[model samples]
Target: MKIAVLGTGGGARAHIAKLAALGHEVHVGTRDPQATLARTAPDMMGNAPFGQWLADHPGVALHPFGDAAARGELVINGIDGRNAVAALSAVADRLAGKTLIDYAVPYRYDPDLEHPWPTPWGVMPAMEPVDTDSLGEQIQRALPATAVVKSFVTQEQTTVVDPASVAGGDHTMFVAGDDADAKRQTTDLLTAYGWRDVLDLGPLVCARGMEMYAHLHSAIGFGLGQQFGGHFGIKVMR
Candidate 1:
């Protein structure tokens, strides 16, 4: 399948590399393809520059966001939490009539929080639209014609693409969306990614809990004393 991954960050790279290894045509999206290629320094997360990464992976193609989205039969959104809605909304026309699997958490990093969780790299970012609203719902509202499924937000992207590496793949994965078919497609993609315990949390509104898991995910990581999400997984026991 021709897949478009919209973003050039670490999470986006995870999907791009996996999809390409899975023999799918992967197109990456960014605000400016040329500028993205020109990046010399690492990203905020300290992931290597996209150009350096791109040089190693020659099969992938990079384009402006809309153009990349226009070329995909399936679109995986890995855009940063803060900018996902606006960036994707600008390409809404290109995404119409397709299933969009969104794995972005809307995070508002406030350095001035009275009490903030600290990570080795920086303070943990706070979730935005947290309690009542979620980034998934926000994106769905922005692109009514597109079927948006919220998923892969509860864990690190590394664990997402390679679930079996943890606990022999006994863990559970969750997907929530308003459209049933879209959720099914997302599940199919997850199956391709080797997920066996995919739980449909029912409706996009359930995404609130999924997005809220961000904090707990961090808490678990901090508890484990490992940076970068602690390389763990959660299983929903029946």
Candidate 2:
């Protein structure tokens, strides 16, 4: 499988590492490959520089967005939710007839806050109103010919790659898309990452619930004193 993962953040790095470990030909897509490699400082969350990770994983190739998307059999949208559409637009034509696993959530961070703060608990980001439409739906609409599957949005980076890191491995992750084949492919990828309780919530519209759940997810993280520390996940008991 030739997989292209976009972004240089922790989420993208995790996906790249795990997918590469699975023996897929992985290409990392970024806006500026040279700038990304030249970055010496950690990200806003203080995670280690992506350059270090890139150095460690020599098997992964880095390319600009268009080139990476053109070369991939499967494309993972790990870019920031706010800029996902703009970033992917560069490769929109190449995405036709391919499975696009979208992990981008329309999460609006407060510019005033230096880091994501647990405040006004159980509230969704103001910018993305769940009642309207989700980021997944928007992206799907943007690329009508692409099979966009919404997934991995509710998880932390660690748990997205290794679901077993959470207790009992009994928690649930979601898949939502109009295409059955795309959902199945996304599910298989999740399973390969040790996710045992993947639930298909049906159609891309259901992503509304998934995206809205960010509030509760954030509340749980705040209660635990850790925002997605791989120790907790939403579990469906039934």
CA lDDT of every candidate: 0.92, 0.84
What digit string (tens of lDDT, one per residue) describes model 2 on residues 16-36?
Answer: 989989899998899998998
lDDT of each residue in 1-238, candidate 1, tens digit only: 9999999989899999999999999999999988988989999889999999999999899999999999999999999889999999999999999999999988887657888877876888888898889999999999999999999998789889999989998899999999999999999999999999999999999989999998889888878987766588999999
RMSD of each: 1.0, 3.1
Q: TM-scores, in order shown?
A: 0.97, 0.91
Clash pairs, model 1 backbone: none
**Candidate 1: segments with Cα more than 4 A from true spot:** none
Please state the error at residue 71 of candidate 2 in Å: 1.3
Model 1 — which ten-residue stretch has the worst lDDT? 109-118
CA displacement after TM-score superposition, residue 95 of candidate 1 (Å) = 0.5
Steric overlap count per candidate: 0, 0
What does candidate 1 score in Cα RMSD to the true structure?
A: 1.0
Which prediction has the highest lDDT against the true structure?
Answer: 1
